[model samples]
Every structure is written in C-alpha cells, then in structure tokens.
Target: MAVSAGTVMPAAADTDPRGYLKIMKAQEMWKVADGTGITVAVIDSGVKLVPGLRSESVLPGVSFMEPPLEHPDQQYPPHDDFVGHGTTMTAAIVGDGSAGGPQGLAPGAKVMPIRTSIGTPMAFAAIGESAKGVRYAADNGAKIINLSIGGWWSLDKIRSAVEYAQSKGVLVFVAMGNEGDGNESANPIAALPGVFGVGAVDLTGEPLPSSSYGHATDLAAFGSKVQLRCTDNKGWCVADGGTSYATSLASASAALVWSAHPDWTANQVARVLIQTAGAPVDGSKRNDWVGYGVVRPRMVLLDRAGDPGAPDVDPLAAPAPAKTPTPSADQTSAAPRRAESAVAESGLSWQWPALGAVVAVSLGLGITVLVKRRRR
Candidate 1:
C-alpha cells in the first residue's frame, strides 16, 4: 500500500516524533519491558536496512520472489525493499531512531524480514509464496508473525500455514483491510481462526472510516496520521489511515507482553490482551467495528491489569457470543458505566470528531491491492 506519488509529502524536521506512541503511552511502558528477547517476523515486500533500523535488530531473512528475466543478477534480497511498505512496517516494530528517524515501540525486539511479492503485479501470484514465508518464520525461531498484507479471497494453503504457525506456538497479527464503510469484504487471512485481526483507530478512539469491519476484527490501534520512515521519503511519511500500521503496533504490543512474561504461552498472552483492552464505546461485549476495544498495553504494563487465563485455552478460538439484551440492572447499568470509565481510564476519549482533510497515504500492501487466489 505504497502512497501514490501525488500524495507524498515532506516530513517535518522533528526526530522520531510518533504521536501514536504518546497516545498509547509506549514510552512509559518501555521502562518496564521493551520487548527484549522477542523476535517478530515481518512478512511483507522486504525490509531495507534503513538508518532507522539497526543491523542487529534485523536478522538474516529469506525472500520468495523469483529473479526477473531482465535482471539475471538481481536476486531480490530480503533486506532490499523497493516499495518501502515493508520497511515502514519493520520500522514501526523495531526501529532504533537513528539519523532522526522514527523509533519503534519494541526497540529491544528483533525483526525477521520474510519478503514476498507484495504491492506489485506479481502480488496475486505470490499468495503461495507468502504462505511458505509464514511457515518459514514460524519454524525459524520467530515468536510472533506480523502480516501487513491481505486480500479478499481465502486460500487453503494460507489457512493451513496459519494453523501450522499456531500449532508451533506462534502469534500471528494481520491487517483487517482498509475497505471503508459499505464494503463488506473481509481480508481472508485475517478472518482465519487463531489470527489476531487488527483495525485502525484515531487518537480519539474512533474507528477510521476506511477500516474494514467484521467479526474478524479483534482489536483497534492508532493508525491514522502515524509517522514512520519509508522509501517514499528520505525522512518520514505520515500515513493518514491504514490497518497495516495498526497490525504492526499490535504485534509490537504482543512482543512487549511476551518479553515481560517469557514463560507465558501464546494463548495466555492473547487472553491478557483481550481482557485488558479498553471497552467498546457502546458498552456491548464487543463490536464488529472495533472488536473488544482499542489496544491499551499500558493497562497491562503500568497498572498490572488483565488476568492471564488458562494457559492452554485460547480466548479468540471461538467467535464471541452475540450480545444478548438482558433485563438485569447490574448487566445494563454497571457494565456500561464501567465500560465508559474503562475507556477514559485507558486514555481513549469517546468524543468523536470530524477527521480533517489531509493527503491520505497507503502505507502497506493490504490497503491498495486485492489478490484473489485462483481456484483449481
């Protein structure tokens, strides 16, 4: 989801001023755990060794792209990113803020870049390649897999790969697509079981109009106006709206939690994230738009909130039960009141405001492309 040439804008001179980090209170949380000893596998175009990314922070990776006939010597290196989308995603997770670049939330975590043909004409043909990349990451000591790519159609190969990763005790976070309102299509991989589907939300905790909504959406995160280093600019670029950035941040959040509790299984970490999330505005248990609520890792880090439920039981294994209207007073008043308090306590304002007009930039492969896996 590279930004179109017309929408590209010069970044401000400020160094590593990511507003979402402040909104999520990530800096404060870093004092407790900065995702050390964790490795997040970024599955995207490729991760260029930008100044923002330290060499040690990025591990040697594999690329699934075949060499183009015109460039016999050009074996697409996993560290060479042409589209900049993958670089942006990587920076969001593990950037070190060198050369006045964006600093990532999980700065202590390592990134394993798994390159695939995304944001190109070969995107549709790379579905199988991406699936293989997933398995590769899962088997190669990656604790979490960050997928900033998505499509409208599902493939059995991809589903099977995701299941394999889950069986290997890997956490997969995926972008929930950016088709705005009226578009009912769900990103096939994001909708799969055991995957954490992430949506985009602004500072005010309002869902971005372009964020795709459905039962698959598990959580929302700061995505609008997110600042990151990318190939689009020599410095930084602000992404107006995209679920891709949200997914990266969510992956980083998981890394931070897992680092703090190294002994916790993937299910335990997932349960704590769900239980500690800011409650939905409407006070329902969960909603299609924002899922349980915006991710508030600060709640878990600072306040020591959230219960790590059964170690073997996955909180997201089954679809959330439908919101049943009950006549009980405590169910009606107490829950909604507590939900409202929780939203405020988590530092997300419920007041919705009209989004200002800005040059919107697509920041990952999921936003601008839809690949259909051809059926046999």
Candidate 2:
C-alpha cells in the first residue's frame, strides 16, 4: 500500500534511497501500519541498539557468549559473530531506513535478540541453543520469531520446543540454507512442522542460483545483492546471498500482516502469504521448490486486488495431517515448556507453515516431539 523511491545516502525523510523499500523507507511501511505494536524476536548474534530502533521496542536480549564489555578477551562464549549475519538480518526487519537504508517491512515492530552461534564449535552448539532461544521468545510475548540460520539435525527437545511455541500461538520463520559448496542437507527448522521456511530470489524475481533445495523451503523471497541497513553505518548493507535474508524478510512481512490482523491464527497468516503471493514465472500456486511461491506481504494487507486467489479456510488450524518426527532418543533431550496464550479463548484455529519448514537454516538436529499437559 505504501511506495517510495529513495536516492543517495542520508536521503530525505519522504524519500528513502535504499532500493529494498522497507529498511531504507521507514515511513513507507508505517503508512500501511500492519506491524504497529507487534514484536519480533531476532534469534541471532546480537542487536546493538542501532539507530531508529526504539529502546522501548527492545526487550532484554541474551547470548550464549556474554556481552562484549564483560568478555573483552575470549572468556565469553565463542558465539560472538564475525560474519555479521544476525545484525544484517535485524536491520531488514526493524531498521529505521536511515541514510538510504532499506526500510524493514515492519519498521514499527520491536526486536528481541538472542545471539546463540558464531560459527565453529559454538555454531554447532547453536543447534541446541536455538531450541532454548525459541522457547524463551514464545514464553515472553513475541508474536513472530525469526531464525535466519539453520542446520541438518532435528532433536526431540527442539521438536518439543517448536510444538510448544505453536501451542502458545507464535509464528516462526526459518531460512533454507545456501546450496553452494558440499553443504546440501535438510535444514532443521524448515523441516519442523510449524515453521515457515524461506528461500532466496534475485532482483529479477527468480530463485537465486545459490539457494539450496530441500523439503524445508516452503517459500521464496528477494535475496541476491539486495541491500538493507547495516550496523556498519554505511547505509548500504549487503545480506550474504542466500535464504538468510529471505527468511528475515519473510518474518518482517509476517509481522506486517500479523500487526494488521492480530486475531488471525498463524495458519491464517501462512495462508494469506501463500494465497496472496505473486508468481514471477507462472500463476499463483505451489511448486516443489517455491511452495506457494514468493510471499507478497502487500497482498496480505488487502491493498491490492486480483493478485493471487485468497484461501477460504485457515491452513494451520488443524495439526499436520502427516506424522511429524520427534527426537526422543537423545539423552540431552530437554524440550522447553509452553504456556497457552489468548488464542484459546478466541477459539480460532491457528495455522502454521507445514512440517519440514527447515530449508534455509544452517544447523540441524534429529529429535522427536512429545505432547503432555503443561503447567504454568
């Protein structure tokens, strides 16, 4: 519904220069106001209180490694980021669109950060840490949780955590890992039953050549050399080409739709993104690789007409019709507990991205999920 063309760094308030539209064009997303008051949890390296992000919007964040000030040397956890992947993803969701930056799809949405991995052993540890981080976010008030990283295993504890988060009415977004190199495996979060997995598409609206393929990738979005806000203060941040940025962007798009229609279930949100998405090559429909196709957040806003056919039923109200795997074998299995939220009283069936939404992430776990009455 909102549109703007930006030029140069530090562009005028009305003119956002970053081509991505959301991160650089702050006011643009605000005009439609689908994400006002919504909160997103960015489970990544860490958020450093960048410009235009609201202090009030920020909740207490955690990290496997201690804060930089506390651990000047290597004493802190090894999860401190060198790749800057998490920071770049954060800007795409909540950046103020400052100085020719890409405006996040939901600029008003606050971020809750959790830095779990930073490559190597610590990154491997993130496989376990992600379950903890997602659990924490759902326990709090995060409506949407974004995971731009992933790997190959699915642990029972992690499966339980995903189920718990969904029971609490949280929407999760995950990235299908990049396809380059020998790294070709099923991404974990994407493989999970409820998480929305994303893939990368270039500016030309084609799936990126580097995007890995798997059952986890449920949808695709712009990636490529697209730019967004950066912690580097350069006003032009290039997201590493892959589904990492795509997942983050999809999460922001979900924030926009959720903010506009808070009562809808997560399944409804997924249906909206799918039913409204624009097909670049063909008509609106699902493909093995692209799923329902590229997500068109604006369509969820109902600002446009005659795009994709709108679905009548909520896709996620009912659990997956198929059997979802659980990782009960691991001795380290400890699933996070979930507490019910306002969704139950509403009696609305919440939907989510189908199981195996784990394509774009960098880590994986093999685990089983079990259900039991949870106590608060």
Candidate 3:
C-alpha cells in the first residue's frame, strides 16, 4: 500500500481566530483526563517541533515521501513541517499554550507525526501512500490517526489498510471535505467503512458552508475561526475554518476519553462521543448535514455517560433487516455516476483553489495552496 515519494507536492493555507478551548469547555475535561499516555498520529505534512510543543509532546514518525538515494550516507529526519499545515494540526492537539498561544484539547497527549504528503491543496501523488501511512501509524502504537488532509482518490489499498487499522482497535478520523456539497466522490477517504468522517461547525454549533455532508459524516466540531501559532513565529494564525481543524480536534478529544479509560476499546470511545454530541438543528435523529452532532467529550469525562458496549462490537454497523429492499430508480442510475467518480479519483480533471487572505503568505514562498481537503 506504499506509494512512491514523487507524488507529494505543494499546496495552500487557511484559518480563523478564536479560543476553541473555552468554546469546547476543555478545562472541565482536563480535570479528568489530560490525555497522558495517549498518542495521536498526525498523518499529514511532516510535523516540526514548534515553539510551544515540548520534545515529549511530538515524536518522530515515518515518511511515505521517499528520500533521495543519492545521499546514502546522510540521515534525513521526517520532522520538517515544510508548509506549516501539519504543525498547525499538531498544535491544536497537544500544544500547552506555553508560548502565549492557545492550548491543545489534549495537552498531555503525544503526537506521532507521519509525513505522507507535503504542502496545502496537495494530493497523494501515489494514493497508496495514505494506505501505508495508516498502517504505519497503527503498528507504531498510535491509538488515534488524524488526517486533516484528503482528496477524491481512494485506492483499494487504502481501504484495506483502514480495515486493518480498525481490526487492531485503532480509531482513524478523516476530514469530510470543504466543497459545501455532500459529494462523497469528492472526498473518497471519508467514505471508507469504520472511519470517523468529521465536519466543521461554528461557535454556535452551526455547520460551515465549506464542510461537506453525506452518509460518511459522523461528527462535527468547531472549525471556524480557530486560532493557533504558526511554525515560522509570524504570530498566531486563524484557520478560516474547515473540516481539517475539526477532524484534528475530534481526534484529540478521543485521546482524552481513551486516556481516562485505558481499557475501553475504540468502539466504546466512539460510542461515547456520539452519545454525548450536542443535538443539531432539524434533529431528525441523524442527517447528512452534521451527522450525530458537535463532539462533546466533556459529557463522557465528567458525567460518566460513556458506557463501554460489547468489546468486540462495532456501533457503526447497521443492524440486519428481515428482508432486502428493492432498488429504486435513483439507486439504479447511481451506478454510472459511481463509475464516473472512479475515473475522476484517478484523473487530474479536478483542480483546487488558491489560499485565502487570512492564511499568512510566507514571504518569498512560492507555494500555491489549492482547493482540496478542508481549505476550500
């Protein structure tokens, strides 16, 4: 499932400005589980040890981006947050606000960074890189995998890798996309079975326009106007709010719950998050807009509402019905579209947009952030 290193490329940045800790009420949850002994694998661009992150909070991980063989005797560390996107994600999950910055939801949690690709608005030049990255993280002792970046591509290799991680009791959280449409084809990784597809919401718990919606959408978090420090020290930057930030936050929240109850399986943690999520508007039990609702990990930590279900059971699996339903016209016509989407995933017909004004432009930096993942 490993892809060649040549496929990784450059992309853009995004953000908003706000104190997410206060909004999510993370202080209350900290009293119970500060996420000690938990490891979150940030499978994005490489993560650097930024100003606020301590040496222990960030750990070295593998890189699918192959290094040049010419430097056979040289050592290359996969710790460079080249485009700063990965650094932003790591900060949101484990930052301690030591350098006058926003604190992470799980300050005591460690981040194991795996660089599968580089830059914003980038795609998996080799789609199998994502698959390999997932497997590598799980095998290396990561309980939760946070993918703040995604694309329309989905390889059989990637699906198998995700299934493998699930079997090992690891939770993988992926961004639901930012196209403002519920197009599963646009963000194929989120459609995989057993993965938790996360979307974005505002402080008031309203879904953002860029947050994609679909059956894959499992949970939502405050992604709009989130504030954190940048790798270059140009000051704190605000992510314009997309599913990328939300997915990272959701992953950190899971670490808190997991750290509190070391014996709970991934299924039990997932069940607790779903049961504790704040109810959304339209409230039809479940919908494509925001799935279960905004993640409320505090409810499980303080209220002790996270009842560990069957250790081996998956809560996301639909119950078996007495009979199979007949295929409707919509279902019949969807076959051709699915085929078309498969073609799109492998092709470069779709293009991403440039970074917005809010994302601080690096001086002399030649990166052109595109419209994929959660930034668009």
Candidate 4:
C-alpha cells in the first residue's frame, strides 16, 4: 500500500517553522492566484473531514475497495481515512490552517478524496482499481489529480486510465519512489508518457538522498522533514522524507497556476512548470537526479517568467514511443475504453476476476514494506 506545508516569514511565527511559504514565495504568488475554482483529486487511503479542512473544501468521493464479504453492498463514506495518510494529503492540498492546522499551498482550491486500499490485505488489487478512480476524477471535473502511491507492477488498466485523463486535459502528478536510488522508471505508471513524475527535496532545496531519480523523474518539490497535520487529530507529523509530499505540493502548485490561467491546456501548464523549475548549481545541465528541477510556482505566478508553450506541444518527450502496457498477473479485465457508457453506468467495469484472491494471498507483506518505506 502507498500513502502520503506552511509558511511564512518574520521568524517562523506561523505554524510551519520550515518557512516553505517564504521559501516558495507562496504568499506573493497567492496575491495573484489562490487556486480559486480549481478542484484536485487526491487518490490515497481516504480523506476524513477535519477542522483543518474548510467546510466546502471537500466533495463527496467514491471508493474502489470491495466491501467485506459479509456485506457486499456496504459502502464506506469517502471522508473516512483508514490510515491517516489520505487525510494528510488532502489537507496539504486544500487545508485552511484553522485552529492551528497546517495550511495548504492552494488554500482556495477544493479536493475530492478517493480512497483505495492502503496497508490492507487487498492493497495491490486496490491499486489496480486505481484506473477507475483516475477516470472518475477526470470525468467529475477535476483539473488536477494527485497520486501519492506507486508500485512496481505495470498494469494496463493504470496506464490507460492515465492516458484517458490526459486526453481529457487533466494534469496528473505521480510520486517517484523514495528508495534513495533514481531509477524511478521501476514503477510503471511513473514511466508513462505525459504523466508528471515528482521527486523529493530537502528544505535547503537540495535533492534528498532518499528521493529516487531517473528518466521518469520529471520534477522535484519539498518532501523532507515537511510538517503535515493528520485529519484524525494526530496534530502535526513530520515526514522523515519521501516523494509523496513532493507530489502533493506539485499538484497544488499546478492548481494555483491553472486557476490563474483557466484557459490554458494541460500541456501548456506543464510546459510552464518545467520551464520555470529551479535548477541546481550547474543549471544548464539536465540529469536523472532531478528532471528539469525543483518546482517554483512563484516563477509563474509572481515573477511571470513561465511561458505557456504551444498549446498542443508536450513539455516532456515520451521516454520512448508509447508502448502498450501489459496487464500484470493481478489484472484480468481489459482497460476501459470509450463507447462504454453502459459499463461506466454499471460501475463494475474495472473489476478483475481473481484480484481479490491475489491481493489476499500475496500482496500484504510486500505492500506493507512499501508503505513503511514511503513513510520513511
């Protein structure tokens, strides 16, 4: 299972001592765009409504997890957070910092929390079902989607869902792994064309040693020692380090930019972000360590240096011509395609026959390890 800020100046008087807002110049950027009218979908454990989240910041969401066998039709509220990971990620995107809560980067944006299985017996299978959640987000008017989880499995369902969302002009942000190495392509979805793969950086703006890097690594953002307030009342918890937090920041930043330029296409927004990212000392050189560079939304919102490139041009060239992703052993159903209105209506289109069995028997231990590693 995989799971998932602050501000300001004048001597860290704000709740966030790290001064991410001051460093990113978020307040200055907010003067121009506070992510108004933008909706970001957070696909993770689940998001539980808490005081930190504004009353209208969250929308009703659907879960892909199958109910316990005893009650096949039992549906869990989308606001429920099983492991506290989803709620934290949701807060990072739209939290208002009310009552000592951690403030979100895009405070004016709204979030749709979609819960999949995390740290559960059905983790991997639930991950396979993420394709449905991705499609749902794109269909439900989400402009930006945040996926803080990743797996080594290369399932076609996930790939197709990503491509579908892109075709709908939705920008997706994915996390590069946190295992210290930079071979981010090891995770299939991160390797997908047009999908943004984000890596982790320390408060000093240097790439974290634990952040993964590779050709799939598209951008980097603050991830190390970042403060997050869990919605389950666990107050502020600092991530030891991982790309998950970085992905959320990048997604929220995208919302801010999109909100500012509502007419720009997803490709144009991505191009601006890449063009304005902060590079390391040898800025001219691009490497696997950090693609383009760490995200600096201020460059686009405040400095106004980001050039929205050709509307139809893709900022990231495909790693290779898009190859058909093979469905892993756990995937039995074909990826959903257009002209499937009936299937979509039924809401049973993406289920796999033996996914439950595979998830129950083999994925628990491995997913447990991956989840723990992400938490660092």
Residues 137-180, candidate 2, lDDT per residue (tens digit)? 89988888887766544466677887888888788887766552
Listed per candidate, the RMSD to the true structure in angstroms reads 7.7, 12.3, 10.6, 11.9
How many residue-pair clashes does candidate 4 contain? 1
Full candidate order by lDDT, most accurate first = 1, 4, 3, 2
Give the TM-scores of the predictions, in the order they appear.
0.82, 0.69, 0.76, 0.78
**Per-residue lDDT value at 315 in model 4:** 71
Q: Candidate 1: lDDT of 341?
A: 26
Which numbered prediction scores highest in lDDT against the true structure? 1
Query: Model 1: per-residue lDDT, tens digit, 188-281?
Result: 6777787887877766666666776666767777676655543433466554536777788888889999998899998888888888887776
The lowest-lDDT stretch of 10 consecutive residues in candidate 4 is 343-352
Instruction: Report the C-alpha displacement of residue 306, candidate 2, in angstroms.
Output: 10
lDDT of each: 0.68, 0.54, 0.62, 0.64
Give one clash count per candidate, in the order shown: 2, 52, 14, 1
List ranges where model 2 is wrong by over 4 Å: 1-17, 22-29, 51-57, 65-82, 99-101, 180-185, 228-236, 280-284, 302-376
lDDT of 3 by residue, 314-347 (tens): 7676541122122356643332111111111000
Specify the poorest-scoring 10-residue window by lDDT in model 1. Answer: 347-356
What residue runs in model 4 are displaced by over 4 Å at the alpha carbon?
1-18, 181-186, 229-233, 283-285, 318-376
Per-residue C-alpha lDDT of model 4 across residues 261-338, encoded as one tens digit per residue: 999998889988887777544433344545667777877888788889788767775333222233343431322111
